[model samples]
Target: MAAVVTALVLLVFLAGYRFYARYVGRTIFKDDDPNFVTPAHEFSDGGDFVPTKRAILFGHHFTSVAGAAPIIGPCVAAYWGWLPALLWVVIGTVFMGAVHDYGALVVSAREKGRSVADIAAKVISPRVRLMFLVFIMVLSWLVLAVFAMAIAGLFMAIPTSVLPVNISIVVAVVMGWLLYKRGVPPLIPSLVALVLLYVFVYLGTKMPISLTDVGLDEAASSQTWIIGLFVYSAVASLLPVWLLLQPRDYVNSHQLVVGLGLLFLGLFVAHPNFDAPAVRMSEEGAPAMFPFLFVTIACGAISGFHGLVASGTTSKQLDSLEDARPIGYGSMLGEGALALASTMAAVAGISLVAACKLPGQGEVLDLSWAVYYDSWAHASGNKAAAFVLGGAAFLGKLGLSPLLAQTLMAVLVISFAATSLDTATRIERLIVAEIGEAVGVKALSNPIVATLVGIVPAYFLATAKISNGAGEAKEVAWALWPVFGASNQMIASLTLLVLALYFWQRKRPILPLLIPMFFVMVVTLISLFMHLVSFWTTKNWTLLAMTVVLVSLLLWMGAESLLAFTRGREQPDSGD
Candidate 1:
C-alpha cells in the first residue's frame, strides 16, 4: 500500500509538471517568445540582481520557500488525518500553488524585478501599495519568528544538527568567494561542499554542541540559540546574495535531493502502511479542519510565501524569462513531493515504530500512530521529532544505525530550515528598507536598522513566555503559526488577484487564474475571522493586533480590487 501510494503521487506530480505546467506556461503567460530582457541583465548590480544559472537560482528559490513548514504543517495536521493533508499538498501544489508561484515570478520579471507587494497598486489600486507593503513586512516578521524558533527547537532536539548547520555557512562563504572572486565554476565547488557537508553530518552525531554543554539550562540554551540564529541571519542577510546566500543554498538544494531520495527509497523498502486514520472525524478541541487544514499546510500545498520569494528574490535573479516554468513552477512541485513524503511518513511510517512497541497486528498499528499523535500536548513544537523518528526508522531498514539515521534525518530537516530562516531574513531586510524609504525614515533605510526592526520583535516572540494551551509555558511555537498560515495564504490569494487582473487587462482568459484566487481568498478570510475571535477572547494581544491589521489591509485591498475591477482597466479606478 505504501509503495502504491508513493507511486501514484509520483505519477500525478509528473503529469502535473508535464502537461498542466507546460500548458499554463506556453499560452497563458505567452512565454513562447524568448527574446526578452530580464532584470538580472538589465539591472545587473553584481550583488542582488546578478544573472545566475537557473540551477543555482533554483537552489535559492526552492530552499528559501520550502523551509520546515512543509514538515511541521503536515506532521501537526496529522491531527486531521493524513488524507486531507496529503490531498491538499499534492493537488494544491500542482494546480493553485505552482501556478501562483510561476505567475508571480513571471509577472515580477516582466516588471523589472519588483516585489508582488510593489505591483499591488498598479494592478489593484494606488491605495494598495503601502498597505500591501506593510502587510508583507508584517508577514515577513512572522516568517522570521516561526523559522527561527523552529531551527532553534531542532538544535535542541538534535544537538548534533548544530555542527553541520553552522558549518554549512562557512563552506558556503568559502564557496561564494571561490565562485565569484576566484572565477571558479559552481559545479566543482558545490559538489565539494555537499561532500564536506555530509561528512560533518556524520561528525555532528559524534561531536554535538549546545549551550547546555557549558552551563546554560535547557530553556536558556534554547533562548540563546534563537538569539544566535537571528544574529547570524541579520549578518547573512546584509551580505551580497552571491556571497553567502547563493552558494550555501545551491549546496543545500542538493541536500534536499539526497535527503528526500533516502526517505522515498526507504518507504519502498520498509513498505509501512497507513497507521493513522484516513479521515479523523474530530480531535477534541482542535480547530475545524476545513479552513485550518488549508492554512496549516500552506507551504507544501499552495503558499503565498512562495509568491514573496518568487517576486522578491527569485525574480531579481531570473536569468531568462523562460526559466520561470522550471524554477518557479518546478520548485513548487518539488515542495509538494516533500510534503507527500512527510504525510506518508507521519501515517505509514509508524509501522516501523509499532513493530517494536505493540503486540497485536491491527490495533497495534493504530495505537502506534496514536502514541505519536497523543504525545501532541508535550510535543506540539517539536513534532518534527515524529518525522525524524519515522524517517530514521525508514533509513534503519537500509542497514544504518538508529543513531546515525536519526542524525542524518535531523541534519536534513535543520539544513532546509536554516536556509529558509536566513533567506527570509534577507527578504525581511529588503522589505524593511522598502518600508523605510517609503516612510521617509532615513534611519530605517539603513540595512542594519531595517533588519533589527524585524529581528528584535522576532527574538522577543521566540523567547516569550506564552501558554502552550496545556497551561505549561513552553517556548517558541503555537503562537504565530495560525496567524502566519492565515496571512501567508492571504498573500497568495492577493498575488493571484494581481495576476488575474494582469490577465484580465490583457484580455486573456482569466478563469483558470481566478479559480484558485477566489478559493484561497474565501477560505483564508473565513479562517482569519475564526482565529480573530479566538484571539480577542484569549487577549492574545500581539497576534490579535497583527490579525486585526491584516484583516484591515485585506478589507482595504478588497475594496480597491472591487473598484479596479468595476472600472474596467481605465480611469484610475475613479478616485480610490
Candidate 2:
C-alpha cells in the first residue's frame, strides 16, 4: 500500500506538471521562438558553445543539478515523517523549483546566454549584480567543499565504491573522444560505457579496496581522498566540455535511470510497510519542520544552484528555445521523483538498528520516531549513510546478497557526489573568471589560475575542523550543513525575484513568479534568523558571520529589487 501510494503520488504530479509546464512555456514565456538564434548556433565555436542535441544536454543539466543533496535532504527531513517531506517535495517542485529553473533558462537564453547574475545588472542595477555574484561565489565555494568531503567520506566508509567511481572517469574520457572527436553515434557508445561501468560495480563488490588496508588511519585516509578529489576536479575543470563534462554526465544520467528503476521495482516487489511515523513533534535543539524543512530539502524542491546550472551551462548549449521546457522543467521534476524515492526509503527501510546514537546516551531503548529524528538531525555529514543502509535493505528484500547490495548502493552515492563535485568546480571556475574580468584582475581570467582560486579555498574549508556540541572537533562540512541550507534557499529567492522582474518588464503575468518568490523569501529569512540564534548560542563564530553576510546580501538585493518594481523604471534593453 505504501509503495503503491508513493509511486502514484509521484507519477500523478509529474504528469500534471508536464502539461502545466508546456502551458506556461507557451503562454507566459512565449518560449517557442523558432526564429530566435540560440547562443550555441550564434557563436558556434568548436568549444563550449557547440550546438547540442536535446537528449545529451538534458543529461548534462539533470546530472549536474541532481546531486547527493536531494537524497540527503529528503532522508534527513523524514525526521518530521514522510508526509511533510512528500508534500513539500511535490508542491515545491511544481511551483517553486521548476519555475525557478525554467525561468532562469528562458531569461538567460533571451539575454544572449548570460548568467542570471550577469542579467541582474541589466534588469535591476549594477549594485545588485555585484552582490548576487558574490553570493553565488560563496554558495559555489560551500557546494564544492561540502561535496568534496562527502565523496571522501563515502570512499573511506564504503571502500568498494572507489574502483568503479575511478573507472567511470576513464570511460567518460573515452566516450567523449569517440562521440565528439571521432564522430561516433552517441546512443550505442553511451550504452556500452554504462554497461562497462556496471561491470566495474560487480568487480568492486568482489575485490573491494580500502585506504586503511594500506596502513593509513581513518583521518589520514580521508584527507588523502580529499586531496585526490581536488586534483581530479582541477584537471577535469580545465578540459573541454565534450571531452569530459558532457560525456561523463551523459553516462551518469543513464546510471540515474537504471538506479531509480531498480529501486522502484524493489519497492513494488518488497512492498515494505511504512515503519516510521507520519509526523512527529519537534524535538528541543532540533530544526522544526515549518521553515527548516523547506530549506533542508532544497534540491529536491527548489535550489538556487539549479539556476546557476540552467543559465551558466545549459543555456550556452541549447540548440533551440523549445529545449528549455524539457531540460529545465523536466529535470527538476526528475529530481523531485528522486526525492520521493528517498522519502520512501527512509520511512520504510530504515528502522531501529540503523537509528542514530545520541550523544551521552549510549544507546536509545525505545527506538521510536523521536529517537530516529534525533539521531538523523545530529548525523549531519553522514546522513546519506542512513539512506544507503535503507537502500541496501530494499535490495536485500529483493533477494540480492546483502554485501553486494550495500556495495552497489555505495557506488551509486559516490558516483553522484563525484559528478557534482567536478561540475561545481567547473562552474566555480567560470564564475571566478567572470569576476576577474569584471574587476580588471588579469591573472584571474586565466582558466588555470581561476580553477586554482576556486579549488584552494574549498580545500581549506573541507579540511578545517570545528567544535561540535559535545566540545569535540568535527569536519567543517558537517558544522556548515545547517547554514548551507539557508544560504541555498536565499539564493533561490533572489533568483525568483530576478525572474519576476523579467516578467514584469515584458508585460507578461508576474503573479506566478511573484508568489513563489515571496513565499521563498519569507521561509528563507526565518530559517536564517533561526540559524543566527543557534550559531550565536553555540558560539560558532564562523557560521554566525556567514549567516550575517548572507542575510545582509539577501536584504540588500531584496531592497534594490523592491525599489525597481515599485518605481516601474523600464530600463533600456541591452540588445541580445
Cα-based TM-score, every candidate: 0.94, 0.95
Clashes of 2: 0
**lDDT, candidates in the order shown:** 0.81, 0.81
Candidate 1: TM-score? 0.94
Candidate 1 residue lDDT tens string, 190-257: 99999999899889889998778799998788778888889998898889899999999899889998
Cα displacement (Å) at residue 26, model 2: 1.2
Find the 10 residues in a row with the least total lDDT in model 2. 352-361
How many angstroms is residue 190 displaced in model 1 relative to the true structure, after the best TM-score fit? 1.5
lDDT of 2 by residue, 284-337 (tens): 756677898888888999999999998888888999998899999989988888
